[model samples]
Target chain A: MKTPWNRFDFLLLPLLGGAFILLLWHLSSHSWSGDLPDPAKTWHESKPYVLEPWAKRGELDQGILRFTFLSLILVAKGYAIALILGTPIGFFLGLSPTFNKAFDPIIQILRPVSPLAWLPLGMVLFAKIKGINVTEVAALFTIALCSMWPTVLNTAVGVRAIPTDYLNVARVLKLSRWKTLTKVMIPATLPYMFTGFRLSLGIAWLVIVAAEMLTGRPGVGGFLWQQYNALVYEQIILCILTIGGVGFILDRLMSVIERRFKTI
Target chain B: MSAHLELFNLTKVYPSKKGPQTIVRDFNLQIPKGEFVSIIGHSGCGKSTVLMMVAGLTTVTSGGIILAGRELSGPGPDRGIVFQSPSLLPWMTARENVMLGINQVFFTATEQERAQIAEYYLSVVGLADFMDKRPAELSQGMRQRVGIARAFALKPKMLLLDEPFGMLDSLTRYELQQVLIDLWRRNQITTVMVTHDVDEALYLSDRVVCMTDGPEAGIGEILNVPLPRPRDRKAILELPEYHRLRATLIEFLEVRAHHRPNSSNSPSGAATPPASVPVSA
Candidate 1:
């Protein structure tokens, strides 16, 4: 309900939350957590990357912005594939009980698997390919495998939820099967597909971190893992912040798309 | 007039955990072209089922429906329906909702003509101003008008009305009935309406068929209203014949229709009146 908060409240309250978290971080760094950098010290340590985000000195020495963009691109590629495959599969699952029964067991088994688990399997699947960087492809594969379930599941659910009244209208109107599917079924199922897409995107962003870390692809997650090994605690914190900020932005973008289509 | 529509021995039985349930049995009716027919019965007496069976929306267990010399099966654009409640797609504008049916029925027509067809029907049903508005933006009566327009716009050979005004308030119901009669008079499409309201049946139908109480409902009595076309409610009330017909329908509904003792068990015992009745009765 709109009673929850005004738009202004949503904006200001999140800022307040950040401030509270910053205060806690500042106090904790000065006390029990000596190795962990405070907000100011972490900012000071990571100033070069923050100020010159376009800098790309080497394979792993790019600015935080570049790493974040790389992660975004990787997630986008996998998310697009997930939509292309998952949406139609979802339609089949939604429209045909036979298809639903056939694929249900496989989907249920695969849906809850961690990207961490899928990454190894992805490496094996792509390892045999020639002329392509296997690790990068594996990371993409892992992201797609982990992110596709929500879209597939949401689309099927949306199809199943179409009002019987509309179906009756289609039947009584003597609409051709193609017209019924395109005019009534597709438009009605679009909102659910969007919802699935939003969830798929969130999953893609989530998996991108683990995917990059395992595959050694140089996204923000790879940087974070590298900084941890190098004992550059401030850089690790900066990577973590970048991942959170980018994930938040991705979620917001997806919800806007979801809201636009849900009117159908 | 030659028979334009015929239903012979129409029956519907639904299997259940308890046993088989016969909702309708041995239903038969024949109407000449351009005739207006009404089936009146108590709630859950399967009146709508009979209408639906004719529309081909329901699977006939063991019977046949012949319209214009063609035996039809399954739902098609040849029969259009206006249900009691508004069933317009909420996401679409009234014109768009109407257009959904028009586009299918008039597929060979140009898009511009299709748009005009939707506009014309919406205007006929008094939705000219609100045609572009979505269902949620319109009042309840306005939405139902869109549904009526959609049905009529199909140019359906037979129009099936299933308690089309059952949900409306008295004032709105009166207004809609006027709108419906005006539309029906112009085209004279063979019509069958299922209604519980005696006044609706008398005011709308040329012949009213009363149904016996259900769990195996069958046709009980038929009353023919010899009132002239374009009949007005007040003018019809002034005639002695109108009052006599009205009283018989009312009396049948009030006393005779619900007085069945073994209707559920016998299917058609003394509780049901003979299928054939004298024109006066």
Candidate 2:
């Protein structure tokens, strides 16, 4: 009976707030509906899509869990490749002013283009060169293209911000160029590199959804689109909710990682 | 090896819109063995410029800088420099920063040897308890102590400092100055420091090189500090010669301060003195 804002009473607010929202949704679902489903009906109807994605395909080759796992793996692969290739290039670009100026216009023009635009080109190039199906390789390339921009840009900015006085210390100590770059430069730029990493993950997630939708892959986006077309309104809502929930989870996971490294 | 640092007619110039502005001109000095020389001047008198030139961070326009009887082409481990700022790597622990100098200068040493040297110097500066702490965790005075410890850990032929305690409060500066004097005496490391504090120069240095203001800055005079070893602070403050030398340095600085702004403004190319006054004979 205490006020909800009190310290011990605070725990009940979220539960009550959720029930209030659902009750309003239930009321509104019947307010003006010829085809609208209530929250209870939607939860029941969408349960299968969560529990069993394989039923739609007429085979058990892939399911919701399988597709989700595959997409996560692809994102990881693309990010790993980007990290290896982009960091060195970023370091070099950030260290030299002349090179930075020379390459800046190209980076500026290229960074803002949509990752989807590269999907068609990536499919063709990978299909012709690697003899692999276009969809799998195209998704990764598109993710890489999108995520590489922030990673490279942030790493370069961090490298450039290293104080000149630190460089003098390294020089007076006669630290070798390799030691200077590895021990001093890399550690100093680690925070910026992580910033790039977080940005790349967000970009990767965005591009993966788009790429799956474009390629008609058996993933969450494709399932969502298919459910919408089938006019299974309850299932469609569930699929949309699931996508948002997973994205939120991924972002939270990234924040945890960012927090751990933020001190550096 | 005995330290023999000599600046043979050292000069420095900065490019200006009109032409070139000279900072230090025809400045000649020599430090034999373990002399602790402090260069004192008002701001804009190119005192720090001289230190930078000696450290090989600044280019010498027309003179030679010799360290331990060898011409210095660039910065080397033979001369370690502690700057006004600690300049410790933010990510590194105090121990790591000190070890950076030790390892780089003595690459052939064993890991234990390197670590021991770093620890010994940290202990010398009374920072052994905070060895594992990062630069951010330490206070300003503590960080400067690490800077000093890092410089001395190299066991270099000479040490160059640029107003290393200029940023600290009076109490902290005085405390660190005493620590520095003790360390320099114990190690017998030849030292050159540039500062604007007359009392600091008087207290810490074997000789104080007072500089005049520039476009063409030159050494005003070198005052030989005759205070006995392990100097008593209160007793030195009471000495008449100490007050007399402090007055002479202050008066020389006041005259130079009035002329520096004029030279600084009159385009770099035009080198004109402002009502030139003769140095006391």
lDDT of 2 at B31: 89
RMSD per prediction, one decimal?
4.4, 4.0
lDDT of 2 by residue, A27-140 (tens): 888886647678899978766656775454532224566566666787788878877877887988999989899988998998888977988888888887656777888888
lDDT of 1 by residue, B1-281 (tens): 36999999999988876567778888989999999999998898889999988888889999899999999899998887998777787778999999988888898999999999899989999988998899888888998899889999989898999999998898999999999999999988889999999888999899999987776677889999889878898898889988899899888877666543234443343433444532121
Residue A146 accuracy (lDDT) in model 2: 79
Evaluated at residue A184, the lDDT of candidate 2 is 83
DockQ of each: 0.54, 0.62
Q: Which run of 10 residues does model 2 chain B get worst, by summed lDDT?
A: B260-269
Error in Å for residue A143 of model 1: 1.1
Winner by TM-score: 1
TM-score of each: 0.91, 0.89
- Distance (Å) between predicted and true CA of A130, model 2? 4.2
The local distance difference test score of each candidate is: 0.86, 0.82
DockQ of 2: 0.62
